[model samples]
Target chain A: MNPVKVILTLIPFIWTIGMIPFVNRVKPIVFGLPFLAFWLIAGIFVAFICIKCLYHIDSKNNQDS
Target chain B: MSSESMALAIIFVFVIGITIVGMVPGMNKKMSLEEWAVGGRNFGRWLNWFILAGEIYTAFAFLGASGWAYARGGPTFYILGYGALAYLVGYYVLPAFAPLGRKYGLMTQPDLVEHIYKSRTLGILTAVIGVAFLLPYLQLQLTGLGLIIETCSYGQISRVQAMLMAFSMVAVFVYTSGLKGVATTAVIKDVVMIVAVVFFGLYLPIHYFGSVGGMFEAVEAAKPGFLALPGGTKALDVGWVMSTLVLTSLGFYMWPHFAANSFSAKSADVLRHNAVYLPLYQICLVFPMLIGFTALLVLVPALKTPDMAFMAIVQQTFPGWALGLVGGAGALACMIPAADLLLSTSMLFSRNVYGKTIGKNTSSESMGKIARVMVLVLTTIALLLAIYLPNMLVNLLLTGYSGVTQFFPMLVLGVFWKKATKLGAFCGVLIGEILVFGLILGKMDPVPFLGQHLNAGFVALVINMVVFVAISAMTYKPESNKG
Candidate 1:
């Protein structure tokens, strides 16, 4: 497996689990949204970027082989 | 005509039109069992995307997500977390699954299981369990369709009437066109759902609370702890959200329909692209949650049945014709996914359960005929369950997930770990399922297990992996396993 793709695959878990302990409170709102809501909303977009990166690496891996 | 009548007319016209269009592709083609069950092992990128999206984001997501948001609040964020988690797994796992399907000519989930384990008994068991779990899920869509029709008609039509009319049409289209029919309808269904969701998500908040930001402000003031985890519901804590997210994410791919859909992909690249971009649809899905929150403040007092939150909000907000369009979209959400579920369950029954036991030497033509009949039987059983055994939409889905997720150990480990023995796979799934049933029956799901209040499915999954690994170690016959 490509290291980049592996990292991308792990990103969603890391972001999801990582935010659990700290991002539980609803203060310091970002983008007019509460902290927890913003975290999940941002996480969705970040996950999109991460998956797109994985797709690129995956295509490269396929080509190299 | 009144706006309600006009809207109802639009919904009926759309449903009838889509049914006609949905059957067009399959009308021109003569289908074998493979084609009927798995789209003849040939679907390009966009078609596969539509089918998978249509399958995943069902009426439950359209309605239940909003309901959970409006009612449960913080716990609803679990929906957002799991979409990415599951798609990431799909990115790696689905490529592996597609090649196996192509290589073995596998047409369903149990076919792949039978291929991997080489155990006919286990294959049949998986098929039975898969269909059993899917029934409640199919019932969920029926309930959603019933909600849409009753709400749109301003109580003009009864729930039973709406369910019968919608599902009979779904059963007919699915029996005639099979997977191709489901895919073709999904294209229209998804497009309609996206439009309706976006319109409601943005419009509800702005109309009721001035803007999205203002909506959150009002929610914060009106209901304390509404925007955070461990919201009003005692069971829906931060831990429960995390546990449910992980379990459902892993469980998402284990659904028989999801895996079987992979067989239709034309290439691994198609699956990969779908995995990556599917999260975009997730972004769209979370909007309904926003609508739900807005509904809480806008719809005075509160709705008794929270699952009707989306429909209630749409009825209050949009005029009759637009409401009809929204109703049509919501109806499509239920029908498209329900059709796929019906197709998958019937295929599972015919290919694995009935074919394995009684019709072992039956020709493919006979099996195809059996599958078509099974679709009618399964849908009718689901309709009965919907009518008699009604439950909360998301609750039914979570229960279904807990049972089907048992297949994960056999699926993921069987692919990666060559040491995984067939005996281990069978025993692991059986124990996991029995434990799930015990937990649910005992009302100890999300109970204190190992000092953590994990979802019952995740708890069972842990026990399952341990048993599988231990048995595989004990049953180690390296040469026999290799061949």
Candidate 2:
């Protein structure tokens, strides 16, 4: 496994759940959502993009997928 | 003539229509045990996507989500994290499972455990736990269906009658169409469910509260911190959120049905490819929470059953036809997955229990037949529970969820760690499950030392990992029995 691919995969774990303790707030609402709600929703897209990039690379590096 | 009749009529149409949709494939061809239990292992993109979604989303998505958001506040966001994280984990893990499965014809989770440990007893133990987890889930579906129909039909049909009629049809379709039927109905269920869920999820906030932001702003103003974690209950804070997220994400794919789905993939590539897009579904979850938050201010006197928040608001506000659509979608959400769970759980009995014990020499055909019979027997039990004890599933759900997480160490370590042994795996499971159950049953969850910061199950998982690693090291001998 590429070290970068491994990091990219783990990013969501930190970004999604890791960021939770710090982002547990009601203010600084982004685009009408509470900051906490906004961050979690954004986390979903972050996960999708991260996985998409991983899939692109893995497909090229290994045919075994 | 009446609103109740219009809604009820539309729901009945959907129930029959989905059954027919599911039944057509199995009408002429006799679906093999292999086809229904493990799938044909040749699912395309749509079917793969449908299979995961079918297994994942259910009435819990609608009622339970919205209710918690409506009643509790911030902790509901935890729901969004677990699925995305589960997929993230699946991206790497499932591809591993695919090839291992094909080589061994691993049709069930117990089969995997059996293969990994070279122990039929551990396999039987897994089958027992797998069924234990599934029964609560199946009960949740039946009760969720009953609630949706009873509320949407304006109480014209009692919850008991709705569950009886609707779930019997679900069982019939499962009996006839098997896995292909579940897949076919899943495609349709998702389409209707998406449209209805999105519409209400968006419409409720916009129509009542002016905009989504306005809804949150109003809710936060009325109840400060309600927009953040621990907003609903004191027991749930950031630590609880963090710990629960750990427990659930690690444990999510450990469900036996997920194992079945992973094993049946045509290629490791298929499994990896699907993982990429599945996270997108997590975005839809935000809608239900939005509806629940919107209901918090709008509903006077609040709701008696927090789960009724989604349906109650829709029933009060929408037209009959719209309510019918949501009800129909909700029923499908419940039924399709419930059908899959029922079939899979029984096969656990027929394959793992019966195959290993009573009739070790039985043919695959006869095993499949026994599994089919098991579906009806299990459904009858679930239906009886749904009618007599609606709240039991909710109570068991807490322990049941944590109980499944204990399997994580066994599955992940067994796959990656060559040194892992059968004795280690078995002992770890036995001890972990006992400790987890003891803590939960003793009401020491959120665990005393950890306080309310960590989830009780995560504590168990940590211990499980320790024992698994420690025992495996002691038991390790140079390239002994691979099983």
Candidate 3:
């Protein structure tokens, strides 16, 4: 619920689904792949990190009971 | 033996082997309705993880992703990030429901609604809608099964025959073992599918074009527009990609069966942990799309059925036994989820509708029996429709996917908002379904003015949320009234 957590969550969303329209280009390929493909593939890893950070700080996810 | 016979033998043996593995757990027990539906809610992390991800990764993932990539191009990548995002949403929504699942011993999604709003009628309404939407989806698995077997057998086994065999096996598997069966079988299906997809996805592009980049460059040269959004397609523009992702990710866990499956988790901790790591599974989705893009160029004659790209490429490249592994994995992907859908839908009907109404005093054992009977009835209905009217099921599934997203308002508001009235959820869902079916059935999807790219279902969801909030505000009474 804190500002940091909220921003962390939004980071993945912005990269994965939110920024698709603006970045829908074939040129300026990253690492030998097209821009769109590179963006999508990298987005998964970004989501994984953001979710991992969110999980540790989340009050409910930490409860043992 | 002939090449066809060798492949057929391997495919059938592999399918039956995994079917028995699925049936091994919880055999020889008289399970109650709760036990039958959700493995008595004692599943540990690994088993819990498997079934949670199992339903979404189906025959559709194996063949359909490649098929979409082959036919639809850049549109196929839409499938990639949505699952990860769904888990992101689950990071919040699932923990909210975990205590409720344990506290009330809730068994189905309708049961959650009933408890949230304190209305049995709402429970019955959701159960009916859930079952209706699920049947069409079940039909899709059967049709997918038929295609896999037909391709595996080199046209020796008819699609109808494959479906019939799958139908019988799936029904009996669930009847004997329930959710445990689905989970155990999911292990084999996931393992074989990961191997097949990762290998083919990497191998094909590198084999033909010398590198992944080379393959993409070749595809770009061969078909210039094929590497980006709306690539080689008219309707699936940038808006389609963005909107479809939102619609699917929001609707992902709303399917009736998903709600029921979530009930089986041991604790909130396990489910939350799943959300963190589950996106790793998204890696498999990428492989299929790569294969699809590779298939676009590698085939000499080109494929007639776009959906056939995965199998067509597999058959052309591999030996009999290797192709058999792909075929067997695809069959399990179709069968296990169909079995789970049948079981959970029947449980929702028998428990929420039948037990709460006509069979008030029926024991959980009898309810399980009743659910079993309903399972057979539903399976027969799906089987007949799959055989008689295949396209009808596909259309219903499209509508069903969008229709279930309508539940997002009811569930999120009902749980988090607290003032969400029963009447509000009822009216909102009804109106949302109407808008979804109206726009989709009338073929007005993407709307006229929204660049023809946004999904129709996403449009309905926004409107549904507005109506739900407005109606709840009007109908909410103070706590003192407590009606």
- Residue-level lDDT tens digits of model 1 in B302-414: 78999888888777777888778878888888998999999998988888888999899989888889999999998888888788878644454656888888899898888
Q: What is the lDDT of residue B19 in candidate 1?
A: 83
For model 3, residues A1-65, the per-residue Cα lDDT tens digits are 68989998888888988899888887776776778878887888899999998888875545764
Against the native chain B, what TM-score does each candidate's chain B reach? Answer: 0.96, 0.97, 0.97
- What's the CA error at residue B231 for candidate 2, in Å? 0.6
lDDT of 3 at B311: 85
| All candidates in order of TM-score, best leading | 2, 3, 1
Candidate 1: give the clashing pairs.
none
Proportion of the native interface contacts kept in model 2? 0.83
lDDT of 2 by residue, B1-483 (tens): 677788988999998899899888789887788787767777777788898877666888878889999888899989988888889888888888878788988888999889887889999999998888789889988988988888778788888999999888888888887777888888998888788879999999999988998888899889999889889787788888888989998898888888887776778888889999998887888888888988889988888889888887887788887788778888888998898888788888889988999899999888878888888988999998877877777646768778888998898899888888888898788888888878887887776454556788988888988999999999998668632
Per-model tally of clashing residue pairs: 0, 2, 1
TM-score to true structure, per model: 0.96, 0.97, 0.96
Ten contiguous residues with the weakest lDDT in model 2 chain B: B445-454
Q: Which digits, one per residue and each the tens of the lDDT, describe model 3 over residues B1-483?
A: 877888899889977887788778767777776777888998889998999888768988988899999988887878877988889988888777767988998888999999998889998898888877988888888999999998888888899889888788888888888898999888778887888889888898888889888888888888886889889788888888888888888888899888877888898888889999999888788788888888888787888898888888887888887777778888888998898889887887788888889899998667778888888888888888888988876667879889999999999778898679988899999999999999998998876544556789998998998899999999898782265
CAPRI-style class, candidate 2: high
Which residue pairs come into collision in candidate 2? A65-B269, B72-B232
- B215 Cα displacement, candidate 3 (Å): 0.7
User: Which portions of model 1 miss their true places by more than 4 Å?
Assistant: B388-398, B449-452
The residue-level lDDT of candidate 3 at B328 comes to: 82
Q: What's the lDDT for residue B365 in model 1?
A: 88
